[model samples]
Target: MSSTAERQGGSPGGHPRGLYFLAGTELWERFSFYGMQALLTLYMVKQLLLPEFAENVWGLAALRGMAEGMFGTLGNVGFASVIAGLYSGLVYFTPLLGGLIADQLLGAKRTVTIGVLLMSAGHLAMTFDQLFVVALVLLILGSGLLKGNISSQVGTLYPQDDASMRDRGFAIFSTGINIGAAAGPLVTGAVAAIWGWHAGFAVAAGLMLVALATYLAGQKHLPDTPPRRHADFQHPPLSKADGKVVLALIAVILLTMPAEITYPMVWTIGPIWVDSYVNLGFVPATWFGSMDSIGAIASAPLLVMFWASQARKRREPDSLGKMAIGTGLVGVAALGLAAGSFIFPAKDSVPLIWAIACYFLMGVGWMYYWPTTLSLVSGVAPRAVVATMVSGAFISPFIAHLAAGVIGINFKRMSPSAFWAMDGAIGLAGAVLLFALRPMLNRALGTDKRKDAPENAF
Candidate 1:
């Protein structure tokens, strides 16, 4: 049988060609983003925020004063965590505005293009000490524009009725994300180790250019952006059912926050932890940042197959259940870190295997929740507000990062074991809440009727 994509004149028996193009574009974009991110916290703690170097940055004193005013006498590490948190948080938050612009004013493609240019400029700016704050502002704004619109475009590739294919497409797209994420830290970390931080930033800038080129190359294959909504245009009011679903989705986003808060810590404070505690013969700590993505990439196919087999037996998990499982696994991953910390103590370096295991588990947990949630939102959100809803889903991570940053400030004060255990407990709490709320969510989202065949039902 000709697959839906094939029937729609996409790649024969596969997905739309545009899917690969979008995935490719995103791969390089993530490569740039993650590459820079892998360096940011470490750079700040080790060099950039130090008194001598900090003085060279144009706005450092004022920014530090404002941060200290808000948070109260932050040490260098705490201050870096706060900045990292704010940067990560705002990147997710801005997508809401980006979605509005795409859905109402500029359309997805043009907005994405503008985003690429701004991000490219941002990456370039990262190479200069004077532009540190400015670079972050640009990257945050650019990412806001690119992230949601590109994701929404994936949904437009397949007919809305083909939920299964849409899910599969997202999985494939996520693979690109994992690959780039896995590679970014390794490459940039190695580059920084060999040369300097600015050299690493330059590489990220180059990668962003490649991303832009890939996006432009594939313009002909992408979906036509809908005409911009006019000032007088009015979407039909959302039905009462959609209103309920919206509320439920917002609840779901909130429920995911516990795990979200714990996950980014793997990167934000993770490198610092690894550098201080892990027994690395020669490997840079930033390389450890790749482990979660590596784990996710390795686990995706096996999980898909496992889910497929379970589906045949009518015992597959619903989206919420899978997300709960994912959340729990993330907790377990944090506990693994806690265990390592306890066993090794602060005086002794932790075994390399412990960090590897923890990061890998976190990745596996990510495979279960992140893409599943994206597919769920894309499949079920009301069409008129789909883009906004998709963007809003990111708000979970936004809140999580902000909270995580605050939590990260305590890393210096707390024992490593206590710190990780707290994170573990938070993740487990989220899982418990998600599991408890599953039935309620089902009814609210109108998926309760299809409970018997939930594998493909969502």
Candidate 2:
């Protein structure tokens, strides 16, 4: 009944029908998720809220976006563009917590299902303007579950030392996410713009449902079993020493985000809020959101090719090392945004290409970070902690987003350049954090560079 047997024990690349089914499910789920994600900030400022502080900053951003689009140019604004910076920043932060839960409690299969379901509900909830905040809470929580665990499962499909195939496998998996991102916004935004915002949420919900059903259909094929992990409430919690370690870990994470936290003070109120301006018909706005996704999509083949290029080398960077470099470079990309502001000061918006370049670089950088990280975690993490780690990784992005919305929103209203600069610093800090943890990773997983290391697995 296992996939190996289903394909008559063929290689994973030639996995049985269920693998494709799982892949399809993920593709659809990502479509719903990214579609809604594409429009969130815009919707927040334009349609969801009123002419309050939140709306003001968002409104200005929208106006700026409109003006630049009209004149065929984008500009940098006064005060940090905290809202934009924070939203972008957060989407990555929450994953740490999400990944942990998946590794320790939910297991890959259940976590993904529950997370996807929650996200689907969250999207549906957003359709209710009155319940906007509640919807956000649900979406963040749901993402914490689904985003981290599902990715880990993809890694779990193979053995840990199977280096030759892991990168290619992840490359295949990441595409499902990009495919969703590429199509989601265009379709959902068009629907929402022509029909209503609620329609967008509804479409997202429908897509998630399809993903969910698709997941269920192949339930028999998934090797992971999580229900057993979370059913252990009788067990005592970690010791005080462990608790302190967890607290310290959190402190480190928090300190890494100061610019991210502090910048929103001005933008929410000053002159640039979105309600204070006009809306650019849906297409361009949605298209702008699609930029990061496009970057993500563009990276898959490129990274896979890069991995292939390394084949001739005696010491190829392992998944972990590549992830480290990728994430660190993401920091560099953020810095590029700061540099962009310097290049084009006081215009209505930063050059579209500047933002686009940032997105593209970021996509290439971060694209390699997670897929590889997941493979490493699945490879070396003790079975007991695998789901937990996944949950934490997933949760980190949610954490990033939650903070982004609360603080980044306010920051964008204040100083724009500072916003871009802050994200660059954050990306760098995340890279450093991983680098610092390199010893732990190296010890447990074996070096990614060594061809003699363990088999490359899921």
Candidate 3:
């Protein structure tokens, strides 16, 4: 899926090599992402402390007898929750800086490399307790650069006429993310468990190095998918009316991020009011935050195919329509959160099935939300700054998180039930806004389907 659809040079075994470059790069990139996720929390709560192996070390003695239990000598919940949420949250939030470096100076390729190097360095830095703060910074920066740019490059592989392949490309790109996320944990978790968390970072760096090597080896395959230069891509002619629509979308995204961040940041505010309403809030918070990813993983391929089929029938959803629905569903998922909290009452875990159900429902909803936004952004952005535009897409969440962290810390005094309800209410607002703007979006961007185009469904 390169920019040029001419497919010169004998089709390279019937498909462009850029696909492999993206596929491999993403695979390794996800490994790093997931690796960090698996161990990040444990690292912060346990590894960074004086006894690196306290959980395993301390728990080993208690295990002389039969069953596994939640309690023994354990880290404090509030402090640990903050650390875990912040680490995961910051990774999303800091991409703003990463996106900037990539756009202005590094380009996606170099940006990814620098990010990986920093990641490896950060992982290594974990060995020194004093360096933990610095290590976290590097890891966040690396993820920010790598996450947004790599996907942008994937889109760059196709020309505007080729919208059909976008979904497929995103699907493949996302697969790389999941693969990395899934593997990073399995591999790093084991390594950290036995050798040390530092060892896991070393392994993550090695994976990134390998990913880079794979990209280099496959560079020739991506000749048609050359890095986008500024000044080529142009915005669709924007009149005052069109400009208003664009502004509206910006507003929608801005509002959406805080709501999105709240899914993960709930506990930050829940404690003050949670005791009065639900017995245990973590169960719901974790479920909602984690639901999006798990849902993305589960539904990506299925939704891609479904959308492709719709496009074939010429009944495809335009970008705005997709966003509208996706946004609505996110809001709907928030309602589910509200209900579960209500049903559980007095600090209890909602039925495990409720969490699973929420994950599945939200997963499908996000499937529509993210790729559609990306496709819409691609359609509207000037080709010259599409890289930067895409970088901005990644940056939006970071900005949102900075706001969320502050808001979350302060919002705790409110009731937990009210808190969950408010989250749902906001998502609904985004959906409505996006839906209302659909006509403008369709007029601005043209049809969303390019089924016969070089780009595949993302």
Candidate 4:
């Protein structure tokens, strides 16, 4: 059924009012999500995950002894990295299945509600040490449902032909996300510093509860989700032509893996770096992670406007090209950090300016890619299989974060400069590959000098 606003037929704005509601919901949801993210790595290493507990729990002592015997000592940093990787990777990976469930069974509305509730429960569960793993599981599952579906719902607001509006809508929605991301860590980190980690988590739980209320109150204003008949989990087989476009899109998405692998550096290794090397007494390490979000929130409007202006002038780069630029920017950002690391002597703190510069550049780089990818995937997906295709794009991050976990393990093993430089090169390489494949990708995805291609066309 069409919303009353839609039925009224003379809506003042071309867009739906529900968009703002959804955007607000997303803002708070991200606030909760990133707030927890900022706390996760440090909490595991410095607070909850004790070595004695590890040794006593499920023969982990023997495993650690074996690991230490082979690869020196597995310190808290390494353990924290592994945990961060596992947590982050699961967050992305489960969205693949979550998107499917929404499409095939629950519909986007119910799925997102369930996701928020689960996350709220998980945040509350974080207060208990015994329920830690359970909390993680709930969070992972909740994020999977909420993350993809909410964005998917945003697209549903616009008609299929309104690509420009959809893209702009996503940018606006992304701005909300960045805003939340920026605020969440700052608030949570400050609270944690003042009170304690559990207190910080309690704040997150409160925020999520608030988010749920906000979403529920505004449900009428949001886009409607058509009821779906539950069916056995099965995707309709793609035609050969559809297969080519999907394969191409997947290939391009996979190209982002290298940059994605390094994303955790800001959160996983960042706190440790600040504590071990930077030695900034007044600023919390979680605040450094907030830099990326702050930068992104600041830059999103400018970038979105720039893209819109470029599109009007017919000078806008294709999505693949934009993503390539983003990939390179990440490398540049990493290089900036690497340079800072080179200048700062070992065991000494670098100037806060260096960290800020690195994070700001990273934020700029992410602006070039992340929202564009969301718009791209949402725009190109076949209507019958939209969620699945979005899920496929998420696979890039899934692989990246999993690799990040492995790379994070070695953060303490390698010099900071060397580690940043190596990953910088990886991002640069991915950029080079993507740029080289631009022409082919444009043809495959059918964005070159053309109107919208048929949904199944190569």
Quick one: best TM-score, which candidate?
1
Error of 2 at 117 (Å): 4.4
Candidate 3 lDDT (Cα, whole model)?
0.58
Error of 1 at 82 (Å): 0.6
* TM-score of candidate 4 to 2 decimals: 0.87
Error of 1 at 351 (Å): 0.7
TM-score of each: 0.93, 0.67, 0.69, 0.87
Model 3 regions more than 4 Å off: 1-13, 38-108, 155-167, 182-206, 209-213, 216-249, 262-291, 305-317, 345-349, 382-385, 410-419, 436-458
- Alpha carbon deviation, residue 10, candidate 4 (Å): 11
**In lDDT terms, which candidate is top?**
1
TM-score, candidate number 2: 0.67
- How well is each residue in 1-458 modelled by candidate 1, as lDDT tens digits? 13444434647347887888889989999998999999999999999998899999988889889888887888888889988999999999998888888888888999999999999999999999989999999999999999888887887888878888877887778778888999998999999989999999999999999999998997877888764756656689999989999889888888889989989899898888888898987889888878999999899889989999888888788888889999999999999998999999864389998799999999999989987897688667898777677777898999999999989988888998999999999999999999999989988987677646554432
Model 3 agreement with the true structure over 159-186: per-residue lDDT tens digits: 6566776566666666776656545666
* Alpha carbon deviation, residue 218, candidate 3 (Å): 3.8
TM-score, ranked from best to worst: 1, 4, 3, 2
lDDT of each: 0.88, 0.58, 0.58, 0.79
Q: Which sections of candidate 2 miss by over 4 Å?
A: 7-13, 51-117, 141-171, 216-226, 229-283, 315-324, 346-349, 382-384, 402-410, 429-458
Q: Write the per-residue lDDT of candidate 2 for residues 136-226, one digit (tens) a residue.
A: 6677777767765576566656556765565666666767777887788778878877887888888998898899898888777667556
Write down the worst ten-residue block by lDDT for model 1: 1-10
